[model samples]
Each structure stands twice: as C-alpha cells, then as structure tokens.
Target: MTDVFETDDPETDAGATVLEVRFTGDEGRLDRALALALPDLSRARLQALIAAGAVSLDEAPVRQGSAAARAGLYRVAVPPPESADPEPEPIPLTVLFEDAHLIVVDKPAGMPVHPSHGHARGTLVNALLHHCAGSLSGVGGVARPGIVHRLDKDTSGVMVAAKSDAAHAGLSALFARHDIDRSYIALTRGAPHPRAGRVETRLGRSTADRKKMAVLRNGGREAITDYATLRVFGPDGRPLAAEVRSTLHTGRTHQIRVHMAHLGAPLLGDPVYGSGGVSPVVREAVAASGLTGQALHAAVLGFVHPVTGEALRFESAPPPAMQALAAALSAL
Candidate 1:
C-alpha cells in the first residue's frame, strides 16, 4: 500500500537513469499530461526537457508549451540521478514508532528538524541519517532524507518522518491538504478571554521584520487555530498560567504562537511572540520550577498511514520540564 512508484528505467554504473518514457493520453498539454502520468518527475524538470527538445510527439519535437489535440504516443528522455551526500552524525533519537515506510519520533525540545542557517549540526536529520543507515526518504530532495513536517526547535513531541520516497510524497501531500490531525499543549501566560474559540487569519512573512511572521491583512496564506483553556492555575487561587490545548487547521509557521499572542495570551518563555514582561506570580513559579523555553509540546499526531490502509494515532506526554512546571502550577 506504499504510495511509492518506480519507473523501469535501465540502471547505470553511476546509479542514474536516462529515462525514455512513451505514453498515450487524452489531448491536452504536455505539462498537464506528463504530471498526471508520472507524479515523481518534477514539473520543472519535465518542462526543461520539453524546452530543450528532449520530448517528441510522432518524431516531431513538441514545443515546451505545446497543447496536444489528440491522444498519441509521446516520448521523453529523463535525466540521470545526482549523488546524494549528507554527513550522518550519531545523535540520539527518541523513536516512537518505526516501520518499513516511516518512523514516528518523540522529538525533544532544542533539536532543529534539519540543518539551517544558525544550526549546522545536532539536527534531527543528522541523527536520522545515522539511525536509518541510508534507508531514509529521498522525495524530500537535497539530501534531506525522511523529513516531512517540522516542529519549532523549542517545541517537543510526537512527529513522523517518511522512510521512502513514496511515503515522503504521500505524507507531504497529506500535510499540504490539512488532512492530518495534530494537537498541541501550551502554557500561556494568561487565560484566553472566552476560554475556547478559533483564531483565523492570513499569515505571511512580517513586513516589519524579515526574521518573523505576522498576521497580514492581505496577500498571505490562510491560518486557523482552535484553542481551549484546559485549566488555569496560580498562587493563592489567583490565575497565573493557563494550560491551553490547540488544534491546527492550517499549518503555518508559528501559527499557534502568533494567534495566541494576538489574542492577548502569549506563551511563557516565547522570546519571539511572548510578552516581554512576565507576571510576577508566573515568574516566581518559573524561577522555582527552573522551567525555561517555550512550554509547547506536540501532544497528539494522527494520520492515515500512507503505506498501509490503517489509521495511526500517536501521543506523547510533555517532557520532564513541562511536567514539572505543570505539577508546580497545580500545587500553587
């Protein structure tokens, strides 16, 4: 049941394929037809081949933008593979579930999903590479094997990574369509006013700052977050912190953090979206509990297995820090 498809391209010494594909389909356009027939070959690469006269129809070079009028045999020449090389590091991983097609991990806070500008090592990808032993998904491309969705460096909990190209493509599509169920637990400074509601907005890169994202009024992706205050606690029966449970309808960067902050309940230790000042009551509790960093955990992740016709749901409890903080909050 794996979503993966393989072309019978003749293999080569360098492990690359010089694909020569021929097919007959309804008359429409090369771009449209090729994409439908071969979901794996990238559109950009297909268009590149057509423009360079690597594709032909009835022995005539098909224009890159040609619109076919009828079903006919079309031939294409696909390029060979390029070497994939990424350094694998023996970093530890907290695996939740593993199978031939994918791996579900209980990712800890402070580990980035992949290498980035400021983080070059100690990432989940580096660790996964070493653990998979070369059996990670390649559909992610650029040597970013097995990576699908990501959590912020400060967020910890249940996550899934694809172990094959087909699984990668299928999972990626699932995330894009918002067909997966994902929930998070967050410790916000103040309780949401209504206690339970949904926040919907258009989100994009911040115009004021390139390094951050903002809820824009125009020209941005749609974002929606549903949140409910699980409980509110403080010292001496005074409200100090609220445990909020949130579900995502759209997966935008910092969507929950931004929406919660916009609603006037910023998360504690959120250096970016949090209120710069902390309430004295919560501050004292944090100090005593030794809690630091954003108190967000990906508590629940559920999805249909791409390679199997089965429903899969995984849950992880908050890490020690979050549990300790919550325990302290209950006492106070």
Candidate 2:
C-alpha cells in the first residue's frame, strides 16, 4: 500500500523534524511499514525510533516495533544531531593546581567528564573550555579536548587536564605505562574476606547488561587493584560497613566497582554493582547522609609533572555526604 508522507518545514518542538505518514490499509508490521514509508531511514533506525517512543500513532505514543500496522496517521519525531564541538559553560571549578602545561581540579560528584548521549551540557569539558579560554590542548579531539583520562560521572575526586599538546602526550604516556599513582576511597557493605590483598582479573562488558562492566574468566583486559580495609564500622566481628582503599595498577572502565563487587565488598550506594540486602541502620544512614550515588572518591593522585618533571600529588577528602555517612556508620 502506498503511504502519503507530509514533511513539516519548521521545527515546532525541541529541534526534532516531524514527519507525518498516513497509511490506508494494514502494512503487516509497524517497523516494516515505517521503513518502507521512510526510505531514507534504515529499518533498524526505525525500529529504535519506535522503541524510543519517537513514533506516535494517532497522536498516541508507539513503543513497540512489532505492533500490527493499522490504517492511521503516524508521526515520527527525529531528533537533531549533536554538535561536533562542545560549547563552554560558566561552571565553577575547584582548582588545585594550574600552570603552563596542565590544570588540576577537584571534580565533584554528579558531574560528567564529557558530553554523551543523554548528557550534552554541564560537563567538565564544557566548564574547562570556559576556564581555559581556548588554551586547552586538542589532542583528545573536539569532543573531549585536553582530557587525558576520565572519572565516572558519579565518582568524585581529583582530575588533571592538559593545557598543552606536549603535556597531553606525556600524561597519556604516563597513564598507559601505569606510572601514575591513583587511589580511591570506597565505603562498602561488609568487607573483603581477606581484608587486604590484590585483586587481579580480566574485566569486560557484562553479557547480560551491555551498559555495565563485569569480571570475566576469559578474554577482556587485565585489571589490577591493591586494596586494604581502612576501617570497619558497626560490630567488631560482624561489621556493617567498611572504608576501603584501592590503588589502581591498571585502569579499566568501572574497574574498582566491579572488582570490589567481585570480592563481595561493592561500594555503598553503587547502583550498578552494589546489590544485596543492607542493614536498616545503614539504609537509614544513607538516607540521612544524602549520599545519592556511589560512595567512591578519588582520594589521591600522584605523578611527576609531564612537562616540568616536578613531583606533584593532590589529595581530596570525601564530600559532605560521605563524611556524614561515615559519621553515622561509626556511631552504629
């Protein structure tokens, strides 16, 4: 059946181009019908659009691609493509050190390092673009200029950015060689069985959930973490929570969180890897402390200056929420 396509010239909402399609008879399947109607868009893209609720039938949102196609008016809202270059934003940064080649800042929790699919603004890169005033190195490309490494959006702590191309290369080399010293403080339920040791494993994307990282028996990359239990709260024999310190020898995506979870000591408030029951006291403390995300902080970062060859080390204490949670846990 031939479908009539009506294109809207003006973007009426959120920079999305709206296409109106009218079907006269059943078209077998919605995705197949949409793909035939919108020849420019791939069938896979149409199916994704339908799943994302960007396609509507008779003004009602359509969420399933396999739904039967009936004679009706279908509206497809195609979102605009993201910009190639990130715009600078006037967001405040806690600068620890700054010089001709590099800048270090105490990045707070909840701030993403760079712009991504759902997060297009209010990122560290946007703030640094404004702070550096176009002086940042372009080695990491336009999307993430000067970013040598990254911390997860919800993991708070020290981060260094390169201001010069030489510094960027040097810092990247240092990280690649595992010469940089990185330490994190994690508040975890229970504790590692041995209390202090090294966790070495192959880490990769989870087979079940592609969005999350996991420990793999084969394949994947090598990830190593040297951890020690700093302190445990609650009862002596059966502690409720413990403060753990992890030192990274090899950096991988979500390395610390996944390793800790594998060791039966996932970080508190970690939404992805932290699963299992928590004590009522700990739950109450978490609510009271206002710790919304994972209780993992990049407590220390030490490395030789890439350009100057001077030793540099920066340390940051946990944020207010962590401090409050620790206090509450201690009192238990």
Candidate 3:
C-alpha cells in the first residue's frame, strides 16, 4: 500500500505531494480533518506533518495538531519517502574486527545504525555498504542489512554486523536467547539508591507520549538490568552524581534510560528521561563537555562467534565528551 502522490511542483520529488485541503469542520481537530481530507495519509502522519511545520492554513503556519479546524484552505507538503535501498556512502568506520562472515566496529555517537526519516544518509549501514562492497547479509532487509541489534543514535559503542546469512541467523538467535554480554556506562544526574541492584520492569510505549518508552505495570516485554555505581562524584558530604555500569539481561528499546529514570537517577544530558534539577557545578561541567545528548556509552560487548564457534569480546572507552564530563565531575 505505497501511496505515491504526484504534484505539480517542479521541485517536488518523484513521490512527493503538495495537498490542498479544504476544511469546513469547526469543531474537529486539524489533524483529523486533514486525515479525512487526505485518505491516503494516516492521522499520525498528518499530525507529524503538522508538528513539523509542513502544513499551512490560509497562508499561515499551523503548529498544533489539535487546533480546532477552521473553514479555510490548508496546504500540506508531503516529502517523498526515503528509498528502501540505501546507497553506499564512504563514511569512515573504526574497524575493530572484520572477516568474510562478520565485521565489528566501534560505532561513534550521533551515527544512526540505519537510515530513517530525518537520517537518510551517513548512517552505519551506508558505511557498511561501502566498506563491505555489497557483500553484507540480506536477512535484516535491504535498509538494515546484517543489523542484529542496535545502540541508540546518541550512544557510542562496539557493534557487530554479519556479512553472511548464516552468521546473521546465528547472531539473531543469540540475541533472542539473551546470550550476549552487553554492558553500558552511564554518567547520571544522581546516584541510584542501594549502590548495586537489579532493575526489572515491564517496558512499553508510553500512553501519554507515543514517541517515548515507559515502564508499564502490565502488558509489555520484561526488561532487566544489573547495575552498580562505579564512582560517586561531587562534594564528599553530598553526592551530586555517579558513574553507573549497567549490564543488560534483556534488550528493549531505551531499556537502560527508562530504567535509570525510574530509579530517580537519569543519565546526564538525557533530554527525554533526564528532567530534573542538577547541581549548578555539574551543569556547568556538562556544558563544558559539549555533549549533544545523553552521557551513555556501550562500554562492553561479548559474544561467541556465531559461525566460527570462537569466543569474541570487545570493549570501548567512553568518547571524549563523556570522559571530559567524568573528569569535571571528579573535580567537583
């Protein structure tokens, strides 16, 4: 059900459309009206378009999706969907290990694992395509070939990609069974109570915010993390923050971030979950560190070689931003 809407705009891409919607519903939501007017577009997609400033009503920008629909002409610009087959880009990769069956690399922060809506280029997939020269496994699909698992876009760490289908299947099975050793280092706003403990919760999409993952009381996948405070920083009398090492027993989306936030000690610089007061000194250090996002890093990854039956493990230190942040916190 690919909707390819053509428009008269000369600059529009092949599948792009510029919709002119005439809404007369006075009480209906703008997004709902647009969705009804353009049956091809989903209501969620319409809402996103409205939020992205892609929709204008009566020659004025409409910022709210829930605004009351006015009797006016609305114009919506629908950008063309990204191509399923991502073209290869010659992005540099820090290769840790490579073979005919698999490749391991230390992925840097800000690099997405694959192409998505806002990140359609310069991803790890594009780099893998160029590096592997089209020799990657297709089991993960064309867009995300060989991707058995993923770290968040802002999280830096070691990653493995399979180059053969056998390796892909074996690695996928290992992840499914939770047989991989995965550990993360998080610089947190405050220390979690009990210094060392296990966090087990059911995690799912938040009912209040669809874009966020939350801890649910029921009806979600189980997530577990074993964590310990490696070091506490700040004045001796008052602990302002701590360095945490979290080992995952189950991999769920944003598992570490959500769990840490649930403990009232979210990671530093985490825009989504880290929403609380911080010591002025620590905040200044975070600013000085120049970290664009959360201070979380995938510090360790260990697994048995899927095809070769060899033990393999990889470790990576935190990036410069996190290191600087740690140093600053230590001085506090």
Candidate 4:
C-alpha cells in the first residue's frame, strides 16, 4: 500500500511542507496514519523515513517506539528528496565458496543480504548483480534474481544463491531434505543447567506483537534447535558461549531466536528478546565490544554440490565483536 504522504509536484525541490491530517480507524500505527495522509510512497519506505527521523508530526520528530495515535489532528513534515540514482558501494564481502552452480557468501551482520522494502539497492544481491554480471540466473522475481534462501537483515550468516535453474532446483531439494548443515555461534546471558541440549517446539507469530515470533503449542509449526555448550561459567567465571547447529526441518520465521529465548538463553543484544536479561558483566563486555545487534553469527555451512554432487563445506570466523566476546568469555 502507498504511504501516508504525497506531493502535488514531484519535481518540486521545496525544502519541506507541513500537512494536516486527521486520524481514522482504531488507534492505528503512526506509519499507517501518515501513509493514509500521504499515498505516493510505500509503507516500508515510510517506516524507514520515520526511523531516519525524516518524518515529523506537529514539528516534532516521530519516535519509532512510540505508540500509535488515536483520533487526532496531526501536522506531518516530509524530508528533502533523495537522489534517484543508486550507486553500488564497494562493500567488502567474504566469499566462502564459488562454483558454476552457486555462490556461498559469509554475510556480515547489519548487511541486508538482498534488496527488500526500503532497502532497494546496495544490498548483497545488488553487489552480486554487479560482480556476477550476466552469470546470475533469473529466479521467480525481478528483485530477487538469484536468491534461494534469506537471512534476516541483522543476522549475519552464510547464504547460498543459485547461478542456474538446475542448481536452484538441486539446492531447493537439498534444503527440503534438511541436508544443508547450518551452524551458528551465539553468546547468551546464563549457562544452561545441562550445558548441552536440543529444543523442539512449535513456533508461530506472536498474537500481541506482529514483529516477533513465539513458541506456540496450539497452532504453531514444529521447529528444532540443537545446541552444544562450547563454554560455560558462573558470573565471577566466564560468560557462557554456545554453538547451536540448526538443521531446519521446517523454516519458521525467527525459529532459532524464539526457541533460544524459550529456553531462557536469548542471544546477546537481541532487543526483541529482552537482551537475555543483560548481566552487569555481560553488558559491560558487550558495550566494550561495540556490538549493535544480536551476538549471533553463522559459522559453518555444508551441502552437496548441486551439479558436481561433491560434498562441500564452508566456514567463517565470527566477526570482530563476536570474536571479542568469545575472548572475554574465555578469560572468564
């Protein structure tokens, strides 16, 4: 749907305009409210604009965390126009493996693997588009040309994209069979009593929060996470580190994060999961490490070659922050 703000003149380079709007419907999202008033942009773009502090209500910047507005007369302000031309930034990427069939990339945290919503360009896909040129195979959509699977925008990990339809089919089958080996390294608040275990639960969308996933028994799909304790310690000792290697029998949204939180060991810096209760030591360590998102990294990926049928394995070391956390935990 179109966003809440629009201008009569698209070419107008006017600095900013004040728009008066009246809220309708039940207490609606601020974005929705704005989009209703401004219909030219997409909802995702509006949210990004809001997050970027480009949208102001009644001359005040709208806070992204604030509750939605009820019936009201609101004055909305729009930011200056952005450049229409998109330039590909030469962002560094870790190449795990590359072949005629597909390419496996060890994506870093905070990088969107592909273009979506407000992130239309300068994504990993865009980079691949430039790097691979005519080599990338066309998938179902125009935006996602070679994409097979996806990692979340903030979750850094190894991901595979096909170069041809045959490769895509083969990789899809392997994924369907749960043959792809995916391993992640994560730091948690407290150590589990057993130190190693498996979590099998049904996961579904949270009824209260649309942005989050929750473990549900009634109607959720089954999800599983196999975890091993890489290291364990008390408060005076080291912080706990866990190696969670998950094979998705069924890929539910946020499966690992939700299941881990259900086990009371949410990943560090996961704002949606209470930050794992943030111990003083952990908090201090995390702050010192300069991590802005969850302390999770995809460490290993393995699968049979789509065309060659040869077993292949790719591994990536944790990013700097994750490595520092590991070092601190080791000393503890």
- Per-residue lDDT of model 3, residues 93-190, tens digit only: 99999999999999999999999988999999999999999999999997899899999999999999999999999999999999999999999988
Best by TM-score: 3
Return the clash pairs for model 4, or none.
Answer: 3-35, 3-38, 3-41, 4-34, 4-35, 4-37, 4-38, 5-38, 238-332
lDDT of each: 0.80, 0.92, 0.90, 0.70
RMSD of 1: 15.2
Cα-based TM-score, every candidate: 0.72, 0.92, 0.94, 0.78
For model 3, name the residue pairs that clash.
Answer: none
For candidate 1, the per-residue lDDT at 66 reads 52
- In model 4, state the lDDT of residue 125: 78
- Which pairs clash inside model 1? none
lDDT tens readout by residue for model 4, 1-332 = 22243344343237765455656555567776666566775777677767766655555667682458655555455555544433345667777788787888988788887665568676887777766665677763566767877777777878888888888888888877778888877777665435677888888888998789998878887887787767664543444444444445556777767767787678777889756466677677788887888877778788899899899988888889877876775665
In order of lDDT, best first, we have 2, 3, 1, 4
Cα lDDT of candidate 2 equals 0.92
Please state every model's RMSD to the true fold in angstroms: 15.2, 2.4, 3.1, 5.1
Candidate that would win on lDDT: 2
lDDT by residue for model 2 over 54-103, one digit each (tens)? 89989899998898888889999888888989999999999999998999
Stretch of 10 with least lDDT, candidate 4: 1-10
